[model samples]
Target: MGIRVAVAGASGYAGGELLRLIAGHPEFDLVAATAHRQAGAPVSAVHPHLAGLDLVLTATDPAGLADADLVFLALPHGESGAVAAMLPTGVKLVDIGADHRLRDAAAWRRYYGSEHAGTWTYGLPELPGQRALIAAAGRVAATGCYAVATILALAPLIAAGVVSAEDVVVVAASGTSGAGRAAKTHLLASEVMGSLAPYKVGAHQHVPEIKQATGAASLSFTPVLAPMPRGILATVTARPTSDADPADAARTALTTAYADEPFVRVLPRGSWPATAATLGSNACHLQVTADVDSGRVIVSSAVDNLGKGAAGQAVQCANLMLGLPETTGLTAFGTAP
Candidate 1:
């Protein structure tokens, strides 16, 4: 028997993606799936893509998940903390929500307008020194889709001191799926298709998480909703610390940071990242350039918002937590048209 696992919040997009991945993982035995309103229905009723899965949707309660060796909580913001607190101490938990991503309590209150639920070991494995922490952590907080893309795009330069930590800006475009599977007027095909719109401009909840991840003192972030369904392209710009060739410095920093990483790819010179190239994969494609005219280093990164940015990342951290190979049951290649 493989590690028995359960997924809470199974009716949502993130949870469906987690189930899709778990169904193929050789070491995981998906034994339970839970949803609130959809309880007692077949999982396929909500996630049509998982048509053959025989599991029924159970109530999202601690007792229903007690048998799981690991539980992935894809609940909406502010929900995971209470559920996680009720689980047994030995059960490994991964939360794909904002509840545990920020270390600063004040920041959490300021943005989420709720009491801070406390922090978990962050789940972005590619960040320097993060994999080891996840390896030993029983509870992990998977980074936000937008925040992960932004952090990965700028972390190397920030860590290398080649860019000023005080000044950074990121404008990222994400497919509609990043908004969750919840029904919303703005997410309707009529509103989202053929349209590019920005939301939560200066005050996106992911801002504090980005700062926590990259150690940036100040950050301006904007998230754009694109017409597609599942990818993110983050364009990050930062001022260089010195007059050195910012492009070369950025390349060296990114190369050194990701040379041994399995999921992050630093694209060759002159090649830029495109969301299509990373669709449905856990890979993050990256490229960097310096604009001498603007005196800034610009980095672009692409990833499947639901993959590397969410579910796939949860699986990655789970692998480390369980002592399994880092790339087990995960892929780097995207699906092409």
Candidate 2:
């Protein structure tokens, strides 16, 4: 028998993506899927692409999920912590929400306006010394989409002590899917199509997450909504520690950091990362350059917000936690036109 898997919040976009990946995984047996208001409905009713799945949506309750060996919580922020507390400690749990990503309680309360749920082992495997933690922890907190992109863009330079993290700026454009599957007036196609607008400018919740993950001294993050359905393109800039060949240093740092990482790609010189190149896959495309005149290092990174940014990331952590190969059921190649 395969490892029994259960997905909570199955009606949402991240949960649906988890379901898709679980269906394709060889070891995971998707035995239960839960949703809030959609309970008692067929899983296919909300996720048409998963029409072949025969399971009905169950209410998200601990008793209902007790049978599964592994559980994936894709619920909204402020929700997963409670559900996780109710589950058995022996079961592996991965949270794809903001509840447990931050180690500072003050930071979590400031942004989420709720009690801190306590931090879990961060789920970004490519980060230095992070894989070992994820492989041993029973609970993992997947990083946010924007946080992952920005952290991946800057961590190499910060780790190499080549960039001053005191003043960092990140401007990212994300597809509408990052906003979640909820229905809101701002997310309507009529308003979002053919328009590029910025929201949560100075106070995006992911700001502290990036700072915590990369050990950046200070950061200003601005997220823009693009007119597409998936992916995130993040442009990050920071001051370098030295003026001598900062570009070459940044490149060398990135190459050394991700040399053995399967999902992160440092692109060729003069080439830039694009959201389209990472769409529908667990890949993050990165490119870096140094502005000698301005004494700044600029890095561009791209990833599928719903893929590597959320569901794919959660799955990747799960594989490690189970002692399985990191890329067992995940893909690094995007679907091209």
Candidate 3:
């Protein structure tokens, strides 16, 4: 029998992506979908791509989520903790928001300005020491889109002690959808097109989350909005700890970490990952190169911000929690024009 699943906040982008993957999943069933603002409307109205689903949007009621064997919470940050608390202990919860990712309560308060929801099993199975963590926990926190890209690019080097975390710098460009499905002035096509601008330059919310994950206390993170529709291309550079060849060390560490991961691929030397290369895909593409003279290693990572960075990751965690095949419903192919 397939595992019955419910998705809260089903009217948004991450929820819609969950439905997209669930529609074809062999071991998962879409039992319920909830959306507070969109309750009472047909889900197809807000998510045209989900038109074939006969489900209607329901209120974010605990009873609705309680009926499912597994629940995916895709609500905004600071909104999931309360809902997660309300779900039954027997039901596994996979949160796609940032509410449950941080391990330290104080760190949570500093970055999110709210009471900590307490930590959940991190959903990035590709992270070093993450597979065992995911396999053992019931509640999972899917990583932030930007955090996903940045950490995937830098963690290997940091963990291998090849780079000093204090001197790291990450500059990432993401599509408007990363902001969310909400309508915002800056996300407008006319304003975003033909422009590249930075938001939360030194103070982006994801900085603390990134630092916490990679064990970096001092990190310079810059998040920029690219004028595209989907995907993120993160270019991360950091000075190596010593005379260790940055490129060779980065390649070895990253390759060893994700060598067996089904979804993250470390590319061949000299080839780099691009946003266009990973469009509409569940895979995270990575490439590492170094400037020996400058003494900096460049790690470029590409992911569909909505997929590997969000919903796809949520489903991947759900699969681990259920003890099913890891790649059950995810697509590895990127869309080609």
Candidate 4:
């Protein structure tokens, strides 16, 4: 008896990724799929990769998802709140958008300019104090794609007192897919190929989410659109705190944080990671080093922005909610080519 799951906004990339991860999950059955614009069309029309699945493209409705044991909401940020509000209490809900992530309403209003969607337990399983919270939460909100990489790369240092909340900088490059499945001029192949450009500099929405998660009040975060079609590589550099070991502390901090996590791996010293290393997968690969001359610790992180950052993480939380093993369907392996 697999847990029955429903996916709202099923025609999008995050939804398709959720479907892909759950299609073979030993403990889950993907029962319902919804998409507002593509309703009444075959799911394959939007996501050709899911051509053979027995899912229908329907509008997001509470009734269609009534029988689900769990529901994964892949709707756009502002849209999840209304849908989540209508679902039944017993059905566990997991949101892979920004709606329920921040605990502060003011911050939410400032960044998103909307009414606060009540906070849910965050879905980053590797955060030191977060797993227990997720295990007990009935509703969970997955971390933002950029925030996932940013938090994972910086949390350990913050926790270990190796970095302060002031003077931090993060610049991340992401695939166009991270922008979502919508049609936009900038994401067109003609505009994207043979080019890399930065967008949403200091004003990126994920900035507040990152600050809230890492407890870093002063952060300079920027996101760039890379030429590729998947994955995120975030380069973060921060001045070391007075207490930082100054030798192996940066590596030790990250290692200690993810040493036990099934999905996060800190690469061996000096072995730089690449986006291709984590494509089509649910792993977050990272490497950290300290620049003694500048008294700064530089950390680089990679993740399938659509995978471990969004849908794959939604599934991982669903597994926890169902009391099944965390790695039931996800693997740390990456595609090589």
Worst 10 residues of 4 by lDDT: 241-250
For candidate 3, the 10 contiguous residues with the lowest summed lDDT are 238-247
**TM-score computed on alpha carbons, candidate 3:** 0.97
For model 2, residues 238-300, the per-residue Cα lDDT tens digits are 998985788899999999999999999999987888888888789999999976578789999
Record all residue pairs in model 1 with backbone atoms less than 3 Å apart, i.e. clashing: none
Question: lDDT of each prediction vs. the true structure?
Answer: 0.93, 0.92, 0.88, 0.88
lDDT of 3 by residue, 159-257 (tens): 899888887888899998888988889888999999999998788888878887888768888888999988999989888887857788888989988
lDDT of 1 by residue, 259-320 (tens): 98899999988899999998878999999998869979999999999999999999999999
TM-score of each candidate structure, all chains considered together:
0.99, 0.98, 0.97, 0.97
Pairs of residues at least 3 apart in sequence or in different chains that clash in candidate 2: none
Q: Which stretches of candidate 3 lie over 4 Å from their true place?
A: none
Sorted by lDDT (best first), the order is 1, 2, 4, 3
Q: Best candidate, lDDT-wise?
A: 1
Q: Report the CA-based lDDT of candidate 2 relative to the real structure.
A: 0.92
- Candidate 4: which pairs clash? none
